[model samples]
Target: MSTAPSVTDRPRRGRRPAAQLVGIALAYFMVLLDTTVLAVAEPSIMISLHTGVAGVGWATTAYTTALASALVLGGGLADRLGAYPVFVVGVVGFGAASVACALSPALAYLLVFRALLGLFAAAIIPSSLALIAALYPDPGARGRAISAWAAISGAAMAAGPVVGGWLIAVDDWHAVFVINAPTALAVLVLCRTPITTTRRLRALSWLPHLGLAATLTTGTLAITRAGHRSWPEAVLFGLVALGLAYGTAAVDRTSSAPLVPASLRRDRAVWTAFAWGAAVNYALTTVLFSVPLLLHATATAAGATLLPMTLLVALNPPATGRLVAAHGPLRPIRMGFVAFPVGLALVAAGTAAHGRPLVLGLGLLLCGLGVSWTLPALVGFAVQHAAPDAAGSVGGILNATRQAGATVAAAVAGAVLTQDRGSGTAAVPFLIAAAVCALGLAGATTRHLSRTKEAPVADHVAEARHLGHMSRTSDGSSGELPGD
Candidate 1:
């Protein structure tokens, strides 16, 4: 018998399933909105706080690094404690952290509170998805629900800059953080309804969690210091991170319940999806980070420029879901990979041409379309390929990789921009992003094409079996023949 509980088994005492989904989506929206809003408000923050570019960059870096480091542990906690409870706690904590961040008197305090925000955010992400999965038991409905979730996130990302810029213009950067309080409170109220809970899994080993945290934190710090610090120091950080990563793998191997279970670690599809997530975000963050500095634009202008891109990102995923349902994920994913580099190249050209508005606009549009095409499919594939009971873990790992990519992007972009705060320097990061997109494209084409070729053969076999046809062998046993 299947161990998974039926959806109908639970009593419907609280909110309806649709209400639950909205509540979860709102919580997720708050997290994504905060990230994008900060991107727009970052320049204002530097001015208000009397900090350097690198210091302002650390605000984002610290939060994302903490988030990436704690994701696996957060997912494990969700699976053990139940998604509803974990999600409620995360929402309350995130709200408190936002209040603390708004009240921060210094840059150091802001960074600390931002890191706290990330720690709680890690709890919200995976559990939100797990809760959605629990709420919608039907596979097809679940897919649609996930598409909606992605759409909500895309909308929040698009709105963040617009909202943040307006707040900064009207009041101050702190208002951006202050706004999160009400939204989080609304989520808390909506989520007060009871939901079904999952069976608690065995507690995960702590060593692997520590190793993963050390590896990501040190690795991000190493990248952040590149071009700003001595090579020897950067190398030491890198080496230490590498050693920690290796140790994490060793611990994973020895542990009964590893942080990243072998089933997921060994799955090619899962890792490929993770890589795609990382690469796409790396490119996206690089663009979001460098464009405002290059144009010497106001927070409002910066947000407006990015608005088209993020809006497209929001609108494209529902269409992408339709495409995935009809043609499978490979085509759209490959198309996205190809378009991403082209878009970056365009943006680079535009930036080099003294921030030409038309060129930059076109480039951002393409980048948005590219991400919209790929991200839903990538996430869907990751979830589909995960072990049945390990959805939370897989969600955590996927998000962790994406955050790590963002962390690297912010660090590298900060380093590049620090050296030359001119519009010309913006092209450098865009070119680098294009190269990363090309790498993702190459991997997608090579692996997905091989899978595509084999698909027809598998289809033919399935058709023959459906037809109740089999070939007789010399030993008188009937079996499926080659190309049957």
Candidate 2:
């Protein structure tokens, strides 16, 4: 029995001690930058393409759905093919698609190109993290690298909107897409090492998986029939998510080289962190999309121009990183839930008082800061808790859940707004956000509570050692470094 314990409790493989952190950082920057850049360019795209709201929205939808579909596969592909190969392919493919998107003259062409871009972008997150783990074997170094990754990602997201806006103002929607090509090309140029390739590619074809993904994407797209929020449609989408999720689970279980590693799904901590992140994302997307609209509508209704209302939409990404990094992620996540409702309340009050952009902007900033904290922390936690080989799978799952939540929120909130126009109606989404956040907050609190009673005696010894090390390291002239 003791020998059995040792066999089963063996430590998993960790990241290698040496990998180029700079390459990984650059790749992630491109991926995250792409994630948010399109939002600011939407108005310009619509006008230039002569597209309706539905037409323009497909740009986002196609990207997201394609990303979701590719993500699971991307992880498995990484294991078989190699992280570097997958990442390079993703970058080159994404860059090509970006150029296509930029050059496209029609809305249909743009959608197609954007979907193509999504396919490549899907690999960047999981593959990058997997590479990080494969490269950095030491837990402390790996953790620091991941933190640095999170910091870069957060900073990119913060910067994307303004950069996107600038691109739109200076040129056209094409500029947004054009910008990606150079960045991606640069990433490829800098990382010249041949990435690993998967044996899975030779072992089996991807047709079945691709078919399953197609079905899910088709069904998800069908839900955008904004006026068709009937029971039948809801049931249809539910069945689609259910069917695809089931097929994925089944195939993954049976396949020798499954897209999501079987070991990854079994971890309680990973699942919990992923769920929390997804729920928060669902709430945040609703808020991010809604607040700007609310502010613009209010301003327009009050006979004011909406040019200044752009400030509210602009508030979020700028300071998200600094705030989240300053405090440990959990506290910020907790604060985010609290701050969300408070921000909404301020917006509600401000709208009622007068359509003041300043108050609205301030409110949006608070909400943004709150999300910044939660997101990176969630990413870090998910990656850390997952098995080493499964980093890509876990990251994909985490991102997939987050995007799924966002997709659902967009549909549901859009429906609500379509049906009603009242202060109370606006409050409904915020209330739902607050409730979802409360659940996440409760989960966080429970984690803390559970940890409290599991205190190890060695923790005291470790703390004393750490303190001594820190004391020695610190010459009374500088603060102790993290993990000291």
TM-score of each: 0.86, 0.71
Minimum summed lDDT over a 10-residue window in model 1 is located at 469-478
User: lDDT tens digits, residues 216-278, model 2?
Assistant: 565555555533456677667667767777776776677654555677757777787777766
> Model 2 Cα displacement at 19 (Å)?
13
Local distance difference test values of all predictions, in order: 0.72, 0.56
Q: What is the overall TM-score of model 2 with all chains considered together?
A: 0.71
Which stretches in model 1 have alpha-carbon errors above 4 Å?
A: 1-20, 133-153, 383-392, 447-484
How many Å off is the CA of 187 in candidate 2?
Answer: 2.0
Please report the candidate that would top lDDT against the real structure.
Answer: 1
In the range 93-210, model 1's lDDT, one tens digit per residue, is 9999999999988999999999989889878876776777677766667667765665565468678889888988987889889988999988977777866656355465677766
The reply for model 2, stretches above 4 Å from the true place, is 1-24, 130-153, 193-223, 226-234, 258-269, 291-333, 344-354, 379-393, 416-431, 442-484
